[model samples]
Target: MAEGGIVRVRHCGAAIFCRRAPARCPACGSPLRGAGLPAAPVRLPGPFRHGHRQPRALLLRPAAGTFLGGYDGRSDLHVGVSSSQGVVYNYDEEGVHRAETGWEQCISIPLVQPDMFGLLQQWDKLLEEFSAGEDWLPHRYDEHDHNCYTYALAFVNSVLTAQGKQQMSKSEFTERFVIPRTKQASRYLTLHQELTAKDFYIVPLPDGENQG
Candidate 1:
């Protein structure tokens, strides 16, 4: 085993990478470090390379009541526009806000990566339209009509249309992608028994004091 390096713990013939050299394995919580110990390979960061970086669209789900909680279980959607360097734009209610903590889950949308400059220009144009009190920015937010879900749908469709791709509606996107992804993530935890494991834990907050 290498110091401060990745390690794997084997239990029931199954093994998983151990983030740290815990006193017991994270998988089975057994004190068997050398039982299935194997040499870990060294990984080093590489220099940045120039290319047409993929543009990402992340759907962020925050805790309930973080924004207006009505339609879906999730509160709001934050679109993260990223490149090779890192996240360039984290579009939210504050309008092109910087990426920060607070999101509970992030669902990525599948779309062809467009030119970085072109994408930036498109976002800039959208911001201009928003500032001009255009149709892009709904006058008010309604649960069933206008809300964060609608805003995200509009933003994504705008980018897709600008890239000559077919547009999608909020319902279609939610049913086909968002809902299914959320279910999958939920199932993963249950399948792994993370909710009942002795070592599994989550700090609880006082009632009425929770924030997204």
Candidate 2:
């Protein structure tokens, strides 16, 4: 009989086929060998590797609002860095300032942990440098051009470029990063509005007081 072909035994009246070499027959206890069985399956490794580390947290907060008696709809942009402790740095009509944490919307971007602390330190140093200028002044709000959104774009791009990452332009940052991630109520506001509008600036909470 051919290898792995079924064989009928007259004595036990049973059919037997051996899939592996030297296998015992099920009905008669006789040894048999077969050569036509399929090979075993191979197991591939899993998608995720063991002991893989997760990326560090880098939070981006984008906020929008209308200042008192400015407009009916939200029409301003503010960006915040959560890497700093207990405060968000933003630029407004009053120029660059730090406020207690209450960003209207936030988006977390993963960054290399090793560089996070250094980047934050650089951010603080930049602010200090601006403060030390002989002609130090807050960024003035321009109706059709320079505004909060412009400040955010410049600040974020500066940090990104310093870290050897790709720098984003004002339009690119707004459309790709800020608009897509911001809340719906404030998402549609653009920098090129024909009518001028104002944005409500955040006030620092008193010491040891929490924002409600």
Candidate 3:
């Protein structure tokens, strides 16, 4: 696999999207010696009509600790995050959608920098503090070009917080993320409408980006 890429796992006759790394597998009992992370839009447990569209959001692996999925070509909004450890997760639109955890339960968190749950917790509160709050996340997601925006931003800020690259009040964070998304929605939405479900995925291979 390339330095930052994902691969799909054919586990128990099912596919799972995983973040790629140079060493070990975060999913099942395995190592990444020759393994890679799968691409997005994978078929996992979901609420929507799922056949093979890129996920709106990805949930964190209990082992990967504090991370989630990444971008796909289908998204109007896009981001690529890489940790110093060479771990990478692509946050695309659909992956974001799949990342939902209802009011009562939440995913297990790992020892992440800055904070994973903290940012999520903060955003949850910020949404309540805002004017248009009902299903605000789903709306903001629709306004953007992809589904992965919420958690991607979370990943970015968490990485930044860990690295001391940036900081912001809740308003500042919202201002920074929302403006670009609202503005760029016109650009990526058409792409989103055109691409089908299969368009978002690719098995991460050694130097895979250069191949067909």
Q: Which lDDT values do the candidates have, in the order given?
A: 0.44, 0.39, 0.33
lDDT of 2 by residue, 30-123 (tens): 4433312321111221111111121222234334432212323433434444333434555556765655535423444333356567764565
Q: Whose lDDT is higher: candidate 1's or candidate 2's?
A: 1
* Cα lDDT of model 3 by residue, 74-108, tens digit: 33433322222223333432332222222111121
**Model 2: runs farther than 4 Å from truth?**
1-75, 101-117, 130-136, 183-212
Top TM-score hit: 1
Query: Please, what is the TM-score per model?
Result: 0.47, 0.42, 0.21
Better of 1 and 3 by TM-score: 1
Model 1: lDDT to the true structure: 0.44
Off by over 4 Å in 3: 1-150, 187-212
**Best-first order by TM-score:** 1, 2, 3
Evaluate candidate 2 by giving its C-alpha RMSD to the native, one decimal: 25.1
Clashes by residue pair, model 1: none
Residue 32 in candidate 1 has what lDDT? Answer: 57
Winner on lDDT between 1 and 3 is: 1
The reply for model 1, stretches above 4 Å from the true place, is: 1-8, 13-31, 37-56, 63-116, 130-139, 175-197, 200-212
lDDT of 1 by residue, 33-111 (tens): 4553322222321111111233344444443432212224334444443333333344333444334343323444534
> For candidate 2, which ten residues in a row score worst on lDDT?
45-54
